[model samples]
Target chain A: MKRKVFVASSIAAALAGCAKITNGLNEWQPAQPILNSAETLNQAIIGTRGTARLYRPGDVTLDYPVNSLDTPHQPEYLSLIESDFTTYRLPVGGLVDHPQTFTLRQLRALATLDQITRHDCVEGWSVVGAWRGLSLGSFLKLVRPKPEARYVVFYSYDHDQSGQQFYGSLNMAQAVHPQTMLALDLNGKPIDAAHGAPVRLRVPTQLGYKSTKWIRNIALVSNFKDIFGGQGGYWEDAGYAWYAGI
Target chain B: MDATAGSSAPLPRARSSEAGVVVRRHSLVTRTTHWVVFIAMIVLTMSGLQIFNAAPYLDASDKSDPARRVLSLDGRTTPAGSVGVTTILGHELTTTHLLGYTDDGQGGETARGFPGWITFPGYQDLAGGRRWHFFFGWVLVLAGAVYLIWGIGRGELSLLILRPSDLPKLWPMQAYYLRLRKEPPDHGKYNPLQKAGYTLVLFVLTPFVIVTGLVLAPGFDAVAQPIVWLLGGRQFARTWHFVAMLAFIGFFFGHVFLVVATGFVNNMRSMILGTYRLGKHEGTGP
Candidate 1:
């Protein structure tokens, strides 16, 4: 695991030189290991570089809300969030050495960070909200993920446009990034239902979609080959790009 | 240099070359930027359309009527029967069904424009499409910056600048384009209409799209927020970007048709090979 982390940081160190080769037009050709490295290196770079794996951020103040809710309210989610998320329990399990669970209060007790950042939607809009939450990296350290765990998959209670369960994933480096957080507050207040209340993954570097909202579980897995649509995330299954750091 | 393409001589040269009357039309910088920007335009447009396909709704921009939406071709549909088929706004000339609708192979119907064939990845992958869009969007911006800087430094930007004197020349060129006038104006490298078209696209619309695109980007917000807020909002910037894209498409078709009608070889050769043959005298046909 340490070696993987070291190789990732090393590759990301030179990612700017290989941006074209990794996510460039050639990514469509699945057989090219060079291209695969480009992607891995891209994630390493974006997620690990200054904000590697993470895309670029505004050098200035990050307080902006582009838009809200691409989908309408769901009754299931409505009922689930009705208790004000005070009863919310975030289950962290699957391929890990120490599986654990945390209630809302317990999560609040962990080390927290407040960041004002932008949320870029794939549909070409952006919003900035202040997020305060416990660091995902701190939680991962506690969970002690097994060496076999490569992908940290996030499952949400929210339903997608296709009526299927919404889920997103991060490669190990992304999941364990120090900045990644389980955001409980938005704009100085608890995140409301429409904004992925209870808890949402506030990934300052990734697109809004990859930051799974209404968090329920985090599953560590070796690969996503057989999961959902077998591409990675719910949107990934519906033909979206799995690695959408851009 | 503007001295080459934007020369204020207002007179066509009498000299000629064996290949053509090679009066340096476009500069090396011009040619390179043009070709690069054209490719970037294709990639940006295709990927943009793909991103649009994911959500495909346009809010009518009224607080009380937030739900009133004009569906994009991906969400829109044409009322059957030929006369009033609600075409994808500006794509009326293109009769392909792919431009406005899709049969999802199931009973449920969907609306889409430009078809998957012309889109990047040619499938429903907004994520991949976005990467391509952002990537090429940067290329387009860089090339545009190069063109602008080169044109400004060389005074070539004046080539596309319109003046009161250029207006009268338009009437004669329009007549010629309509075949009413037999003799073409001696407007040198570019005629009045060409100048106006190029001017509007290069100095006006392209910048509008670029600035608005920056407004839509989350990363550029600190610097772009003022402009974005002034332009109504992020959604409005996106709306204008879409409008600018349509304007480009319109410009492209008209530009291509004119190139084909006015000695395709001479026009293409001038752009690519930097040598345009003298009309009729050089054995070239329009």
Candidate 2:
């Protein structure tokens, strides 16, 4: 009881001086200043504590929409023209020794595998899809990233609700995980425009936001401080955790 | 098998009420856990509603769009009537100015489930709302663990569990609640309804929410995949989580109403001070 009272008093005292953790713009986040840092401390703890997670093999989705695709055009994406994307080149810049660009066909020609995994979203929904692509680890080896590169940022042609350019970032560790892929095919078929056509990043271990849907550039940087808005991803830029393992 | 099977003192249900005798009704541990769970429940509910507002509703599709939101709950937010529709019970809440779906104040429609008034942070940040929900999630989880461990250590948990004999008393308890009986059965501190409610909240609902919640977390996906498959799928699990929150809201309000209805001061005093007056109307003071 004494302990409880002490703890309660401490929390009450802390709350007495509450300030808005975030008052800027994020589409899906609450605008209430009272709720800004409410969960940030908690998320930080979870993010720091549970950095690694295991991926269990699961069956393919039994249905669609709820089971497969979550979005098509809600966040605006600029699809390169058929001819432009046919010869599309993904610029691999940032802290890399062998800065290179690979066309969609070249990326598809590399060693690849099909992975059927569940896509978990922070918005309280998930779906299973068979994603086929070249392993990010393999791609990283080809580019030969510099030792200083600690994070990977994927730029998207997609626009958020507020018309800002969409982007997502990941720790280099997650960026090169075996399950991480630059997906070109979904469910044994060439990826369509509705999805991130041509190619997209797929990191099964992270939330959907971390998996950037449009293929344009892969920048290996020491930190995301230099990226647009610098929150890591478009969602992260708003109010999401930079490392969304959960 | 029973940790404290022989150590617990039986509740004195038949103690005489002469001179308005008082009895030790609640233990310090139970009281603390109850209040902590109450606070956690409120935070979890509000944060949950905030998250739900982002999507506002659910739809199952194989070729689902890769957009932010294609469908939304329609209210006045949509044009005079733009075929915007959503449902809670069997009734479709498609009319303007309905609960959850409302005008975004910009001419354009937005399907935010609940207003800022009731949700945590009173804003649309799904990320922040999730953080708040998870913070209290651990509180609820830890408090529940302590309750199980301590309740079993003291053998008090058996008091809340439904027994075969409780079936026969169900009718009588309902009659008492309905005011059909003269007085409540000489229940030991907690009436039958209280026992049932407590048992459901502690044993059934709490575990259900925690397990379903675990399934929702991406980190637990591997370890809990089988459980997720068993429950159906990830979306099904989310739907269950939402349903459980509603059930919790119902339980919370019902619990409060009962406490207030059955002599609020006495009930509060028992949970707070440990000593409770002998009868429903034994003492004016708690």
Model 2: DockQ vs. true structure: 0.20
Judged by DockQ cut-offs, the docking class of candidate 2 is: incorrect
**Which TM-score value belongs to model 2?**
0.73
TM-score of chain A of each: 0.73, 0.72
lDDT of 1 at A235: 74
Q: For model 2, how does the per-residue alpha-carbon lDDT over A1-246 read when each residue is reduced to its tens digit?
A: 999999977864443222121112223344434334434543454342222233334445545243123333532333355454675688998899899988877887884667877677777666678888988888888889999998888887666556677777777667767778888887767777667777888777677777787666888988877678776777877767665665
lDDT of 1 by residue, B1-286 (tens): 2245433342244332223444656667888898999988988887787777765544433111123343344333347532212333333333334445642212222455444545664555666666677667767878989989987887667656766778888888899889898866756445678778887898799889887665554334433446756766556666777788889999999999989998898789778856555653232110
Candidate 1 CAPRI-style tier = incorrect
**Model 2 misplacement above 4 A:** A1-82, A93-99, A125-128, A144-149, A157-165, A187-189, A192-194, B1-19, B27-29, B59-72, B76-84, B88-95, B103-111, B154-158, B163-168, B280-286
Q: How well is candidate 1 docked (DockQ)?
A: 0.09
- The candidates' interface RMSDs, in order, read 11.0, 7.5
lDDT of each: 0.65, 0.65
